[model samples]
Target: MFLFYQRSVHTWFFLCNFSSRKWWNEETVAVVTGGNKGIGFGVCKQFSIAGLRVVLTARDADRGQEAHQKLKHEGFQNISFHQLDVTDAASRTSFAPWLLREHGGFNILVNNAAINGVAIDEVYSKENNISLKDFLVCIS
Candidate 1:
């Protein structure tokens, strides 16, 4: 049985019971968006540890390269950095060709890029020291 749980707006927990089989190798490439920090970075690290070629993409070139360097310095060799802004049409259009030309196309894509859209009341949140959900509940 396969179980999928929605942990939050930005995270999912997956559990699966299936026959153990190998499906990927060093050539299997995974592209992770917003991989310069947080959950994205963690995903990139895990994929690298699993021996898959990881393309760690971020909107910021400097941050992305820094993340890539950090991984490499830690002895991860199957990783690369690429700049990708998922919100921009031009950037997306150009990235596809570059990816194909350089890596022959990717096998997996983690669409992890995100921006928090909720406008929080900073003063109220700080004074109350409440979570976002709690703040929303109090206001509403």
Candidate 2:
């Protein structure tokens, strides 16, 4: 019983040391798309504060660069900028390779880019008894 107890303690010690070594040496990288402003920018700031290397991307180069500089000026040196237009395949292909080359690997990717549109006529028509499909089609 004493031998068995000693073995268990040794095993636990070895596992703890191994896990600690693995975690201590690992670097985490993150990318936030549409991160120059709004929610994406907030996420980037949070990640940078959390010690992750963050790349904030936007469709406009100037905006992306400006955001990067702003974060840096704010003492978040781990943040950088990249131009990404998700709707364009060419842009995605170019950025993917660049990301892989620069960051070894990315542990996080925040896709916050979106489009919102609302039609007042569609809303009024729905209130006036239009079908759901028709309402959706009208909005589209």
Candidate 3:
């Protein structure tokens, strides 16, 4: 099953699925932001491999296209690319209409895009000295 969270104004909707199933047919589609690298890239790769139509977005058009090509070269055909920057209002505005018209609505979303403030090894080395505020900021 999928759970959807629709923000005010009904501009964009976020969907999350907790099921263990692989592919749920074409009824399911996904849009993953910052999906050109790291965890976001991994999620897109797996979702595409599972047979879902995956739209992976990145701020850099070149990088996004390269990532899409890499995935296709690796045999992930259900994946595509789009330019997006979650922090930019213009990108968000443009994305809304495109998503609604292209996919109708997304059935899954992986907000895997995040900025790391500190190295994991360094954090573990000084666990007791790490302030709560700093820790929260790091994860945020």
Candidate 4:
């Protein structure tokens, strides 16, 4: 698992070359959190195209379903959607049982869920002769 945080979104990517693995089949499930948009959505699409069953999860059900529909419209039928707020205990606890029952548990997990915990101080950074890149490097 590799996590990259940028612009308040935590983008997670499973860092294995799936194409090289013969065991990765249609029944193999990949769960992607924050799959409503951006890197998460792209990961979902790639996994779907690669013939793996993909569970696209988001904190917002409406957005998650919309993304699932978009993938379906693009002719990818292997994608499914479930609402998951990783920050909430109830949501996190319920998801495991649901995933086990629905897809026999997942083989891959992309932990792309995040909350905006950072507020950039551009003025302060400038005054201190700090570049945005330098600030990000320091924080991360």
Predicted model with the maximum TM-score: 1
- Cα error, residue 47 of model 2, in Å, equals 0.3
Compared to the true structure, candidate 2 yields what TM-score? Answer: 0.64
lDDT of 2 by residue, 104-126 (tens): 76887888865323554556677
Query: Comparing candidate 3 with candidate 4, which one achieves the higher TM-score?
Result: 4
Off by over 4 Å in 1: 1-17, 116-140
Could you tell me which 10 consecutive residues in candidate 1 have the lowest summed lDDT? 115-124
**Cα lDDT for residue 49, model 2?**
64
| Residue-by-residue lDDT tens digits, candidate 1, 21-130 | 76778999999999998778877877777678999999988999999999899998889988998766788898899899878999988888884443234555565766
Report backbone clashes per prediction.
0, 0, 0, 0
Task: Between candidates 3 and 4, name the one with more favorable lDDT.
Answer: 4
How accurate locally is residue 39 in candidate 2, as Cα lDDT from 0 to 100? 71
Model 3, C-alpha of 132: deviation from truth (Å) = 24
Best candidate, lDDT: 4
From the highest TM-score down, the ranking of the candidates is: 1, 4, 3, 2
Over 14-127, each residue of candidate 4 has an lDDT whose tens digit, in order, gives 455446647678889999999989888988877886689999999999988988899899998999999999867799999999999999999999898766443234445565
What lDDT would each prediction earn against the true structure?
Answer: 0.80, 0.75, 0.76, 0.83
